[model samples]
Target: MAARPEPMTPTGGRLAIIAGGGRLPHHVAEAAREAGEDPFIIPLTGEADGDWTGFDHEPLFVGDFAGVTRAFRARGVDRVVLSGGVRRRPDWRGIRPTIPFLFRMPRVVSTLLKGGDDTVLKMVIDLIESAGARVVGVQDILPSLLAETGPIGAVSPDDAALADIRAASEAATALGRLDIGQGAIAVGGRVVALEGPEGTDAMLARVAGLKAEGRISARRRGVLVKLCKPQQDVRADLPSVGPATIENAHAAGLAGVVVEAGRALVLDRRAVIGTADRLGLFLAGIERETMA
Candidate 1:
């Protein structure tokens, strides 16, 4: 059985939510606000988009790597609630990098290329902390958002689907280690889709089409697996699942989801699990090493 995480206790301090695109960032920001913490949001250019003013925190655009650090400093951010999709690649083209960022880019990119996600992001966290701030989990400030363990829904995979789940889990973790992709969809023990820059929904939708076109051969529904890259810095980001994940899985005719336990997050746990249950999607989390 997967462990059910407890709701977070409110830790007081102004939390700077450095947000990027995706539901998780917004979820964290909302969770922080509901906890009565002073929530500030900084939207990374090309990543986070929404009504900034409604969040009740001033939104600043930080593009270059150096600008991000300065943005936090300017807002008196002592602790940060790091959340959502800050692209590792997409933001590079147009960035007007500050001098500091340019000087550090070689080291950062070198780490990314030669090391795992953990290696690359740890360098980043080190950079942030060196600038006199702390980086903490979304759960630290938003405990209720942690994903709980259990069967989320009624419909689990049939025997063949379970096989696919197992295979998908293995492949997904391997890919994560290589920094290839976080998610992979498999049918009949073969990879049908591996998540690319377009994200999970796109991956699922495309694989569903492939299955319809007779490219995949699973007798039952497909299986989807997302993983935290092995050696990833847990403090910064982990692969996440939520209501949206389960919904997308079902739409793609998938039977279940497998994420790295403790290393992955389930946002809106109750609603996500309940929806998965209602939709007959199996939800499971695993440790990265053991599962791999």
Candidate 2:
């Protein structure tokens, strides 16, 4: 295990977590509290988990940009973290843009119309920073969530599995460069599936269907490769996997899962490892150079 960095001191004022769905935001809030900061949360409606009720949180629609900014300013928050999954874009018609949101409206509209996910995220980060708050990566508050390079379970990938890993990694990276998606699957050195906007679990489920339909040879299993998009701003939207990912991979009949070391989030690390071990699936994290 790597030595963990000391928790950041709370000198920059209270942290504001703009939370979406999944366990990550809850984890971030808990970690922040451990670090002596009472983090406030702005949970997006229909996206955030209910676990946030114990924290200082207000539920708002994802499109409520003005409301989020006003809440942060009112709470005297100066540092921010964006965490978790937002699978859907907000309904634009219902949004009532605040003055600050209006100032950035043109650029936001342009990005929404022309740019990809990464571009939209970069603009959102800019919007938050424009409100005079510093945006930090979730890993900054919870370093242990960052995956280290190496095998992480009882089973390790063999030579064949490693080849699949390499092929899948390259394919995933290429897709990422186009800002399309962050995951791909390779079986016997052949690309089997590429993740689209549906996300990783859905991609894996598709792979399972392929296997059931005999589209993928039953004799050959694959590895799922997930990485941070090459052009992605690492401070937000890092690729993440958890125990559920392991379950999905096993169901897909995959031999293992691979991720970029130090750039991906591994949530519930212990549970993820335990699940992989029980299912006889390998989980490895490799350096970017290894994929090249």
Candidate topping lDDT:
2
Q: Mind giving the per-residue lDDT tens digits that candidate 1 earns over 1-292?
A: 4353554544544567778777777877777777676677877766787767776454445335556667766667777766877665423454455665677777765675576545656776776676667888776765555444434445455677667877888888778777666898887677778876677888988877776787765355778988877666666777788788889888888888877665678777778879888887888765555543
Clash-forming residue pairs, model 2 = none
- Give the per-residue lDDT digits (tens) of candidate 2, residues 1-292: 3333456678768899999999999999999999899999998888887676678888889878778778988999899999999987655576657786887777777777788888888988888888889999988899888888899878999998999999999999999999999999999999999999899999999999999999998788899999989989988999898999999999999999998888888999999999999999999888888768
Q: Which stretches of candidate 2 lie over 4 Å from their true place?
A: 1-6
Pairs of residues clashing in candidate 1: 8-143, 21-47, 118-233, 152-277, 153-277, 261-286
What C-alpha lDDT values do all the predictions have? 0.70, 0.88
Q: Show where candidate 1 strays beyond 4 Å.
A: 1-13, 54-56, 65-67, 87-102, 108-120, 288-292
The lowest-lDDT stretch of 10 consecutive residues in candidate 2 is: 1-10
- Give the TM-score (vs. native) of candidate 2: 0.96
How many clashes does the backbone of model 1 have?
Answer: 6
The most accurate candidate by TM-score is 2
